[model samples]
Target: MKYFFFFLFCLLIGIISLTAQSLHFGYDISGNQELRILQYDDDSQSIPLPLNPEPVIIIPVPDGPIMYTATNGLEIYPNPVETELIIKWDTQIANLLVKIELSAYNAKLIEEVKFRASDQKAVLSMSQRPSGVYYVKIYCSDGRIINHSIIKK
Candidate 1:
């Protein structure tokens, strides 16, 4: 009877541990099957696994309104710029009021300017700013807001 009770206690513990474990399966470089069962204790740190070449595909189906550009002639140049940033748009959108904002990575506002859009071009100086990543947000009068990421060196 004592032996039967000891066996039962061990079986219960095994079942509990199995229920608390996480299992992952993948193929190794040699085309062999790899199974990983991990259990984390308070002192153990978890490390991320390397990305698999064949990953699961997730297709996004948007449920809300989708915003798209009405015109395709918008252009910006000299990415990773040092001194100046140029913006040019379609001639059809000329003379519209545009609110241009330059912001840091943390959404902190740095400079804001309002300009009348011209098909020719508009130049913005970046010589005074330090080297970092910045975002330029252009808000058009037709409710279109475009965002461009720029790096200043």
Candidate 2:
């Protein structure tokens, strides 16, 4: 008789254990899965949160914005000069072809620099030209030209 009662008790214990579930506070033990559960104190169980608010799901891929400008200004530094001069410009140009031509009585090319349309600035090097009166011609890709007279002491 005692042996029959023991067998029934073991069977009941197994059934209870098979029905009970192991839970986690903030995470899930299952691998390769992401679970977000919400618990209510009134109910002694947990339920999954809404997967996504919108019924028709759509996700956007991140992408960068477009950037471009044009150039319309120039700056020549340190008049009454020396061996070298620094040239800068205020530009609102985008993806432009730039050429800086230095000329005197007999025109000679001084320096040339190139910039992408996105870059509106450049630094020119002119350390080798002799001290004399010179002309700087700035040419744009769109057939626009600017000229300036500079003196080197």
Candidate 3:
């Protein structure tokens, strides 16, 4: 009987794959071990399958620098920095207090600077730092946070 149910479940999964829908399998957290199916119309959402299914979890891996920008008038360059890095913001945010933080890939704080955007620019010297991956976070007085990735060469 157990084998029959297993075969039936396999057949059911085969049929479900024929349709344009998504199947999410999960167990009930209350120890019920109930099977749940979630269907989605689009393929935007996905869950990585375990390699062996032995209670293994999948994690997102980074291939390269994870960079993100939130401000339009702000610029940081040149990436893969050699010695110095420059940050600039337009006059639109000139009156806001600006704070820049440079950190290592492990999220260790390296350096920080605070100034008014009216200064038009700020320079961070990376000449003394070793070549590696780093991150920069910007905090604005108006509650805006920006992030960028930097590579030291």
Q: Give TM-scores for every candidate, taking all chains together and pairing residue i with residue i.
A: 0.50, 0.41, 0.52
Q: In candidate 1, which residue ranges exceed 4 Å CA deviation? A: 1-71, 95-97
Best by TM-score: 3
CA RMSD, predictions in order: 12.9, 17.1, 15.3
Model 2 worst lDDT window (10 residues): 61-70
Model 2 ranges with Cα > 4 A deviation = 1-71, 94-97, 113-121
**Residue-wise lDDT of candidate 3 within 79-133, one digit each (tens)?**
9999999888788756654678999999999999656566888889999999999
True lDDT of residue 71, candidate 3: 58
Clashing pairs in 1: none
Model 1 residue 129 CA deviation in Å = 0.7
- lDDT of candidate 1 at residue 108, scale 0 to 100: 94
- What is the C-alpha local distance difference test score of each model? 0.71, 0.58, 0.76
Tens-digit lDDT track for model 2 on 57-82? 67763333221122444555556556
How many times do residue backbones clash in model 3? 0
Lowest summed lDDT across 10 adjacent residues in model 1 is found at 61-70
What's model 1's lDDT at 106? 92
Clashing pairs in 2: 69-92, 69-93, 70-91, 70-92, 70-93, 71-91, 71-92, 71-93, 94-117, 95-117
**Deviation from native of the Cα of residue 150 in model 1, angstroms:** 0.3
lDDT of 1 by residue, 52-144 (tens): 457679977434322224355666767898998887777765655367788999989988855556535678898998999998887666666
